[model samples]
Target: MDALSLLANPTLRDIGAGAILVLVVLMIITGRLIPKATHDREMKTAITRGDEWKQTAEETVKVNAEVLSQNSQLIKANEVVEAFLRSAGPSPADTSPVGGP
Candidate 1:
């Protein structure tokens, strides 16, 4: 019964309203304290998977940076070698990969 009925018939509905009120108050209090998404098993799993993806993305960026740096160094070294070769003109014994006269 509602609070008004329970109040009018205190002998019959003595603890009914009080019990419902306590339950509602408890729910309100706990809802504020508890995290909604973490309570869900699927949501917790999704959060963990999101963290894994973030870590993977960070690792990918780090590896890509290292590869880019190595490529830059290789390009610089190749330029230096080509400049030396052009200055030296064709060598009789030069069997380099670039192949020259």
Candidate 2:
């Protein structure tokens, strides 16, 4: 009986219109907030990626510096070995081609 009364009354129509208006207002509010939320998320992601790239660049520079230091030490050792060879005479097995007939 209550359902039939609601269906037969103008009050029920007013209540339905008010409910629709509330839903429309809520939809508009959510529509405005969604883009702001998406922008915030994208900015956070960009910052994280930038930080990761910076760390990787720093690590690459450190590794290259270590490799350069090692290479300098190796070059010094090679020069010392070459100097010792120059101070010592050639072995008997090392014949000079310049003296060949």
Candidate 3:
């Protein structure tokens, strides 16, 4: 028979409807299960990566602290140099003229 006539048959229509229903149910089940599986997998990966990131962040902070400590020491030394220069007054270089050509 023609396509429309075949679809018009009650037996064929019922079978098609049942197949669609089964497909819908399977889709619903997979829709629920796949994302949960994906989410769980992603969470596990994220947790592992998070630990690695945490360690990297901690190492970065430690390095930054060391750098800050060094910077502070440098600042203190600069302050000492500035104080010494101020106490020493103008150097002879300040009054000296450049050599004439």
Candidate 4:
């Protein structure tokens, strides 16, 4: 009759159909599940890195403030010491031998 009359085995049709159906089902399931999982994990990793950057920024600001505060304190202490020394007066004379020009 038509092409159906020239068959080697009619069972090949069912095997081919089943294999195609299985492949389609696998592709559909994996397509729906895989990309969403990958995106969610990548977002979490980026958020964690952002958190680390934020913490580092906060720590840098804290250290800078502490260093500035210490420097200000040192300047005040030096000013006080210099005032005390000036008030005590100077009256020292070197008795070393001088070189002739």
Candidate 5:
């Protein structure tokens, strides 16, 4: 008999049809629904990990920016000192005769 006819007759003689229906339901739950739930859980965990990495990257960028600013200031200060020394020329103490001493 067809499935519609089997549902119409709910007697002991139709036990086989009922058992088949129960097995199909169990298979659908195990093969499709359970795996989907597990996949969704894994995706959530991965997204959380990605967010943490993004935060760390942002902090690293801020630190790098501060270091770059400090380096630029040091370079400017070094340039100023070099320019001053070039303009000052040699001191009088260094004017002694080279061959005598």
Candidate 6:
């Protein structure tokens, strides 16, 4: 006669049972699909982070190599200048008087 009575009717019981079965099936399907999708997203993020780290490391190595090259060139220039100064300095023979004392 009313809503509750209608639901309790034998004919309506089959309809309710079918709806409950459909809900259970959908829950199971979504339960499997959701975790797989989440796992894929997390893996993609991890891969992107790994690539960025690799790039950063490469850049650091390149900068360090440039600095080392500059330092080596500077050291070689200093040595050349030191050699020139030594050649130009007064000799022991020149230190004594030109005419005997």
Best candidate, lDDT-wise? 6
- lDDT for 33 in candidate 5 is 36
lDDT, residue 5, candidate 4:
65
lDDT of 5 by residue, 1-101 (tens): 99888778868556787787887789878774356778899899999999999999999999999999999999999999998997795666687776656
When sorted by lDDT, best at the front, the candidate numbers are 6, 3, 2, 5, 1, 4
TM-score of each: 0.51, 0.56, 0.53, 0.52, 0.52, 0.50
Point out the worst 10-residue segment of candidate 2 by lDDT.
92-101
lDDT of 3 by residue, 1-101 (tens): 89999889988776766798888889888775356778899899999999999999999999999999999999999999999998887666676555633
State model 1's lDDT. Answer: 0.83
- Tens-digit lDDT string for candidate 4 (53-101): 9999999999999999999999999999999998785535645555532
Among residues 3 or more apart in sequence or in different chains, the pairs in candidate 5 whose N, CA or C atoms overlap within 3 Å are none
Q: What is the alpha-carbon lDDT of model 3 when measured against the actual structure?
A: 0.86
In angstroms, the error of model 1 at 72 is 0.7
Candidate with better TM-score, 1 vs 2 = 2
Query: Which one wins by lDDT: 3 or 4?
Result: 3
Q: Over the stretch 1-101, how does candidate 1's per-residue lDDT look in tens digits?
A: 79887678857666677887787889878874455655687678989999999999999999999999999999999999999998888677777767534
lDDT per residue (tens digit) for residues 1-101 in model 6? 79999888987787776797888789778774356878899899999999999999999999999999999999999999999988986675676675655
Better of 2 and 6 by lDDT: 6
Whole-model lDDT per candidate:
0.83, 0.86, 0.86, 0.82, 0.86, 0.87
lDDT at position 51, candidate 2: 100
> How large an RMSD does model 1 have?
10.1
Model 5, position 79: C-alpha lDDT score: 100
Ten contiguous residues with the weakest lDDT in model 5: 28-37
Taking every candidate in turn, the Cα RMSD to the unseen true structure, in Å, is 10.1, 12.9, 9.2, 11.5, 9.0, 13.1
